[model samples]
Structure formats: C-alpha cells, structure tokens
Target: MTIYEPTQEALRGELLQRLAKLSAPSSAKGSVPHGVDSGVNVFGYCVNARERFARSRLPHPAVVVVLSGTKEVWRGDVAQRFPRGVPFAIPAGLEIDLVNIPDPQSGRYESICITVDAPLRQSLRASLNGLPDGPSIPGSFGIALSADLVEAYGHAASALAAPEAATAEAVARHRIVEILLLLSGTHVGRMFVAVDRAEQLEAIVYADPSYAWRVEEVAGMLGMGASTLRRHLKQAGTSFRQVCLSARMATAGSLLSAPGYSVTQAAQAAGYASRSHFARQVRAAHGVAPGRLRSVA
Candidate 1:
C-alpha cells in the first residue's frame, strides 16, 4: 500500500524467492498478478506488497508509476528512485527489476502501472517536451518519466479502481489517451480547460474568425512555456497558423451549411469583421471561393 523505508528492505528479502515461484516473471507472493492484456488493453492495479515482498521481471512493456509510496523500480539497469506523486514511465523493453527504498523508513509501497505498445511509446517520446516547440526530452531505456508524470497517475488510479466492461473498448483506450495528454500537457483539458491558455489552441476558431489570438493564449492556459509548445507542435507536424485556419473554416463552414445563414451571416458568425475577409479564409482553407463553397452547401 505504501512503500516506506523499512518496508522496502523487507520486500527485497522475499522478492527473489517469490519470483522464483511464479516462473513467468512473478511478483511478490501475496500481490495479485492481474493478467496481461497484450498491450491492446491496459493491465493495471497491481499491488505487489503491503509491508514487504518480491516480484518477477515483467514479460512485456510496463511502468509501475508510483502514486503514493517510496521505492526503487526499474527494468534492467536503469534504476529510478521515486516518491509519492511521481508517475515514472519505464519504456517497456528491459528486464523487470525492483528494489524497496521506502521513505523515512515507512517500508510500504504502492503504484499505478500502465501498459502500452512501442508505437505509443514513440509518441510519448516525441511529445515529452510537454508543449509545442519545447525541449525534446528523449525516452530512455530506463529513464524515469518527466516531472509532469505525476498528473497522469491520478487518472490511471481512478480507472483501475473501477473498470467498466459495459463501455465500448474504445472508451477505455481513449481514456488512456486522455491520460497521456495530461501527462504530456499536450491536450489543454488536462489542466483547467477554461483557465488554461493552452485550451485556446483547442478553442473553436470558427467561433470568431477575425478574433486575434496569439500562441501565448494556448501556452499560458496550460501552464507551459511558449517555446515548448511551439517545438512540440512542429514536431507533431502542425504549425499554429495551420490549426487556427482550420478551426476558423470549420466553424464558418458549419454556419454556412445551416439553413437561413447567408455567406455574410456565416462570416460574422465565425468572428470575421468583414464578409470579404471571411470569404478569403474559406478559399484558403478549402481551396475554393466562399460563394462556390456556399453553392455546394
């Protein structure tokens, strides 16, 4: 439950023997081995020990992100020392290994683990700057996840606590995607949707086509540095101008396609000060004149 100081030492004592018993990379004897899911689904909520225990190496990619605990966990040589509120991402390739190093001698440990495939792992790697044009934080063979890691751990814990079978499988996967966005600070919803500036990037451009917006709006909203957000967007193959134009046109097109909404009305609806300007944007976005697009609608 909590991997405090004395607890970690105690866990190591029994770890090897218990692992020996499981044969296929086992965990501490009493801890549940919640079955694997081929990475297509997430296998989660694995508690290895209460006071102390042993575990075996995991067969596939997995990360035992510490939600609340003190311990050392790793795959192969890259050992990570972490505490409560840290979600360390262990790239899912190395040999499974863990050691108990609880805090203030508490001797107890607990964590929320997520299992995803290598491609997702690459995405995480490219997106780690946690913002557009931010520094590129490379994924490691055994590196601990970013300081931003703590955020996603909360979501994983909640989901693992109450998995729903009735929901479509896509719902579950999307939830993981949500967690990844939060962890990376890419999706503005992770923080305050209304208050975070990053949400502005997520803002409906069509809502106000002529409205002047700056990159700072999105960067500020998400509490991320502007440079980082820019770099990330570039790496992800998008520029700020591109996203903004798309947002505006999408909003205007929706308005244009509606009954009783003329081209002028649609332009104003999309926040354009002049219908002519709105028309030009529509042409740029769809590669056709506004009237032409309107004719089709």
Candidate 2:
C-alpha cells in the first residue's frame, strides 16, 4: 500500500474535498477547531499563503494529512518533506521547524493534524500483543496513508462535526483508534509505544514553559524521587535545565508563529524578562533571530 506520487495527488484531491466541507471558517490562523480535549483530538488548518513555524513542538504524537499544499519539517540535519496527499507521523515531544507552502494554482495549503493521546497509545500498543517498541525516529516520517487510513480520517472529520460535542468526542476517538490500528502495520507503527520520560518531561514543561521548573518539583509530579529522576535524565544525557530551555524555546517559537505575536510577547510567554537574553537563547536554539522568525499575516 505504498502511495506513489500520482496516487498521492489523487488522494489529496479527495481528502481536500472532504476537509473543505468539514472546515469552518476560523478567525485565527492555525487555531484548533473543536478544541483539544481528553487524549484524542482532531483539528484542521487551512492557510491561504505561505507560512513557517520555527521550533514548533508536538507534545503528543501526531498524524498529519497534507490536503492541498506541502509541509517541510527540519529535524536537526535532516529535512522530511510531505507534499499533498502524503501522510506523516511525528513522535511525541518533537521540536522542529515547519514550513507550509501553498499550492501555486489554488493558493491554499491545508492539513488535518490528529494527536494520539497517552491512553490511545497504550491501547494501540497492547493490541500489538507484546510487540517490542520500535526505535524512536528522530523526526516526522512519511507513511503510506492507504485507502483505509483515508477512510478513517474522513470518519474522524465527520465525527468532529457532529452536532453534540460529546458525540463528536466518542465517535472521533473510535475513528482515530481505527486509524491507529491500520497504521500499526506500517514502518512507523513500532514507534507508537508509550512516550519516554524525557518526552514526558518536555511535554510537561511545554504545557507551561513560563513556569520556573525545578527538578524536585517536576519529579514529584512524575511520581518519582528527585535522585531517580536525575539518574534517568543523566542516562539520557540531558539535564533539567536543558529540558526546560528546550521546552521554553519551543514555546517561544510557536508564539512567534502566531498572528500578531511580538518578540517581547513571545519572550514573556516563555518566561523571559530580558528581551536580549531571550533573543540570544532563540538564536542559539533555532539559529534565527526571534524577529526574523515572526509570522507575517
């Protein structure tokens, strides 16, 4: 079920038609429609022009379908590109620079991002019958979105648009579970096990990057002693400071990607009082000045 370039083009056409109908006119660019709740949530974004989000962090694993345009993700030295109709999966707690390129003729770039929550990941893993977890890939990787996967997305989208919010949640989860089950047979399926501790810490810090996080406090939340937490992080070759900074910068990058976000606001959102200091950190992390990374329109 490998999706070739031609097949992807045709698939994208059908996906766009389904998503366009499901898409409600959003006042905010890249805003999550239907809200993010529980462990599973679905949202669609349509961009009329080109956009880039630097150091954006995905706290949960995501499966994205590029509807009309293309998505380019930079993970360290590698660049993984997903053109229209190509679906990709990103591991939890991944920080990457993302670009959205609109179609030349249609002048639009749209995608549907579905995040798999912890509970769903566990359920999906258990269904594998004790299969060992797959190696964690460095960044987002493209996967063959077979006919069944596409059908799952269509069902999820429809469920998201259900009149009752509760109904939408229930039906969408069922559909998303089906999608994951189908994905388990792919190369990326093995990476779908429970997220690691470092990833968990990063997600927590990302949820509120502004908070001054101490190792002791965070360890308490994770239900472990400070020493054990430190040992775990030490084995992973990272420290609390590094994790906090990564989460903060990722948060700052995301803020800069939003419309009307100022460098100072982004800095403050990430808990930096000094603009100069924040600029230095942003440059160190993303290799770009905060002002340069600001989103236009």
Candidate 3:
C-alpha cells in the first residue's frame, strides 16, 4: 500500500479527533481527545453528564472513562458503576446501555469514552506485537474496565481537547499503545465478555449449533472436570445451564426477526431439540410469544 506523508500514528490521532467530533455526548463539555492516526481508526470522543444521562447502542468496541461525573454501564448481563476516575469497556458485537446517576451534591456530572472500532483490531495487534502484555487491560479489553484505568483514561481523554496542532495525535497513540499491551497478554479473550457461562461455553459446546451437545461436551469445552467448571461459574455469577438456555434464546430471537425464519425454523436453528422447548425459552425472555416479534416492517 502507498503510504501517506504523515506517519500512520499522525493519521490515527487525526481520525480519533474526527470521531470525537462525530459523537455527541449528552453533555456539552464531553471529553475532547487528540491523537495520531497510527494507521488505525480510533473513535476517541467525549460526552458530558446530564441530570440523568442515558445512551442507546452503537456498534463498536468502546472504552469509556468518567472525567467529572459518575455513571453506570450495563451490558446484557453485567452492570458496572464507576466515578470520575476510572475506565470501562463496551465490548464488540454486544448491545450497550448507559445511565449516569448524578452526584446530587455536585449538581452536574460528565463522562468521556473512546470506541476502538472492531476493524481497528488489526492496527492494535500490529503496533505492539512484540511488547510484553500489561498485567491489565485498562478498559476491560471490550469486556469491562477497571477503576484506575478509568482515572488514567480520564487523564488521557483531556488530550482530545487539546488543539489539533498540539498533543492530539501523540496522546491518542499513547493510549492505544497502553491498550495494545493489555490485549496482547490475554491468551484467549477470556476477560472480554461478562456474558453468561453457557454463552461463554458455546465456543466449546459446538459453535455449529446443528451439532449435538451433551452436558459433558459443554463442560469439556471449559477444560475443567464437569463438576469443577460448574462450581467455578457458580462463584463467578454465571452457570452453563443458564448460559446454554440464554444463548439459545438470544439466538432464537435474532433468527425469528429475520425475513424468512418461521418460529419452527428459528427453533431448530438455535439448537432446540424441539419447537416446544424453544418457544418456552423465548416466552420466558421476551414475555410475548415469538410470533409477536414478527417484523412490522
């Protein structure tokens, strides 16, 4: 590929600022970030706090940090609440729900977040390929972020507000490097998702749902004796039982919404041995029958 005159890092920084420009947080003084292009596209943006700030889902792998307010982040099954000095992750390919519970004494609150595009995964791996991994992934590596990372990201976020000619690109590139080291050390994205155990177990339960899966088959995927895996997940707030059921239910919902999937078909696609069991799970998760979701469109 032909290279641009500005180094990739320089370009990455500029793109990050541009991304921040495109995203409007609930508040006016959201975190403004600056950085170099680094040949990777980073969505480094900011948003301010409101009395009650809430945002819908956007597709990307995002890391958020609170600057001057407190906020709560909810994934499908996990909830994380943090104050102005910490960071968190919104993993790739998952729906996100955000809410900012204000500190009444302070009267106002704010937060800033940066989204690492799923495609940008390539750039990150390339930059720090040889470095030893950081002991932690400041923002959960798309799973969840830690409090100190929140503080550091809060500090890094200010770099976005810097003038374009200033530390904008350099600053963004710096944070990206920090994130890269964190991810490289993770052998398998073990810490990346806070979803249920069965859902987590699906990688081993037969990614191809068409295949049969016995309980032992699922347990083996976790690389532990069945009893041990069951015990560990119970302590971790998830279970393969719930995981399998929830995963099937989640999958059924998607297929049911598609243009050609009849309820019977969606049931089979989600690994239901029979339609009755599939419909039962659907009813439990959505309250309404699967048919209710038939496209209005």
Candidate 4:
C-alpha cells in the first residue's frame, strides 16, 4: 500500500481539531497527555497543553512528529526546531532540554513520538540484509522528515486509533515496518539500520555500571583502538568518561526511585564507594538530593 501526502496546512488543522477534542484534565498543572497505549512498540503522543519549556529524555531512539505548534530541542551545544508538520529522529540515550510553544491563535501544542527500541532496530537490520546493497548512509543525531515520512506517520496515527486490539496492534506494526522500508530506500535509511557505536557503548556501561570500565577496556570490548573509539565518541558530541558518568547517574536515580531499593544499594550499583558521592551526583543530575528521588519515585 502507498502512503498519501496531505497538504501541510490541512494536516496541521486536522491534528489540532483532534487534539482539542481529546484534551483531558491532567493533575500536573500545565500538562495534558493524549496518546494511545497500544502496549506495543509503536505508541502515539499528543500534548494538548504544556509548560513553555521542559526538560525531558526519550530513553530510546525515536522519530517525533510535530502536528501543531513547535518544539525546540537542545542537545549538548546544538539546538534545532521541529515546526508543525515536520518530523525529526533522535538518537538513544541523549538527555535533552525541550521547549514547546503553542500556536499563537489556537494555543495548542500537539505532537506524536514513535520510539524504536533495540528489538525494532534488530528487526530493521535483518530486513535490510535481504534487500540489495544500497549507498552508504552517514549517521546523525537527527534527520528532517521527508514527504514519505509525513504520509507514513499520518497512516500510523490513524491505524493506532483503531478500536480493535488485534487490528490496532497489527496495523501499528505494519505502518512502522512500512516507514522503515521507505527509509531503507534512502541513503540515510542505511545508517538508521546499523547499530550506532555510541548507543551500544552506553548500553554496555548502563548494564553494569559497577564494573570499573577503563577507556582502553571499553574500546577493546568494541574491537576498536582506544584513540579511534574516543574520536568516534567525540564526533558524536560526547566522550567515554561522560557516557559512563551519565549512565551511572541514571542508574542511581532509577534505583533510588524503585521500591525497596536503598540509597546504599543504589550507590554501590552505580560504582560509588561512598554514599556521599552518589548523593552529590544525584543532586547534580536532578537538582535534588537522593532522598528526594525516593520520595518522588
């Protein structure tokens, strides 16, 4: 089946109307969550209302479409804007600060985010192996959406709205696969299929933060020279030491929030020999003490 490209203005209008109709009262003062909980890989998101600026992380690689309003994302020293009717891809494990602006006339901010986790990436890689060889695709933290991508997103949104559980799941999966196929047809799509070295390294460190991970050892595990690995990470706007620290801090935060997990346990798991050090890192990352994380988590 082919995807249909609708006019950008028309698409934006439709999304705004749908978001206004589905708007619900949220306990959090300036937030409204509108999305389908399909219990599958592909999920939808529509924020009817939100703070002017918010800090958040995707936790996984995702393609986010802005239906209405605008989203400004700042990663490291770079910032990009995804305006209405545009979509962008984000790499995994990056902490981002976001600014969401509503339309001046309508006062609504609506969007949809499709997350592609490890399992989905593996599936895409396997599927691409069967296709004929394509041109090399360079990796980037994000990519602008094409007309094909916009059409595919519209189809996925409609499919996810289906009432039947089985039908919705099947349709959602199909649309995702279709999008991947379309991407694979492009040079950039080839890059998306290949596992990003930075993402892989981050995952490894996150899995076992307690291990003393020397830069040389981590590079050896990836089968690359230490200097080469460092250069690769530098090109990605991060360093090995930063990745390890971020992973450890993220793990510590999760542990502190989990039930029955003590601060000591979190500290140890995050490779912190002292509770004070763990607390300091937690405060730096979250602007709150470790005890506060437990209360909120």
Ranking by TM-score: 2, 4, 3, 1
lDDT of 2 at 190: 46
Model 3, span 196-282: residue lDDT tens = 443346333222343444566555444457887688778878876676665556556656766777888777767776767777778
Q: Candidate 1, 240: how far from true, in Å? A: 36
For model 2, how does the per-residue alpha-carbon lDDT over 1-297 read when each residue is reduced to its tens digit?
975554765766676666665664644356456545567777778788899888676667788878767999875456788887777877665456899998898777777787877776777767877433221221237776566777777887787777476576777778778888887776466445546676567655654566677788767666678899888888889988887898788667767866767888888878899999999999999888898888431
- Over 4 Å off in model 1, which ranges? 1-59, 73-79, 95-97, 102-106, 118-156, 168-170, 181-297
Give lDDT per model, in order.
0.46, 0.71, 0.50, 0.62
Can you tell me which runs of candidate 2 are displaced by over 4 Å?
Answer: 1-12, 26-28, 35-37, 132-140, 164-166, 198-230, 233-297
TM-score versus the correct structure, for each prediction: 0.35, 0.59, 0.41, 0.51
Candidate 4: the clashing residue pairs are: none
What does candidate 3 score on TM? 0.41
| Highest-TM-score candidate | 2
Model 3 spans > 4 angstroms off: 1-55, 76-78, 127-168, 183-297
Candidate 4 lDDT over residue span 1-297, tens digit each: 987766666665554444233333332224333333332254334454655444454545566666567888874455777787555665454445787777676676666666666666777778877432322211233344455665665576666665456676577678767876676664334334436666556655653577677888666656678999899999989999898888788777767777887888878878889888888889999789999998998
* Comparing 1 and 4 on TM-score, the stronger one: 4
Model 2 lowest lDDT segment of ten: 131-140
Clashing pairs in 2: none
- Model 4, residue 195: distance off in Å is 4.4
- Poorest 10 consecutive residues of model 3 by lDDT? 133-142
Q: lDDT per residue, candidate 1, 41-85, as tens digits? A: 453233444442333433334444443356565533445566553
Q: Which candidate number has the best lDDT?
A: 2
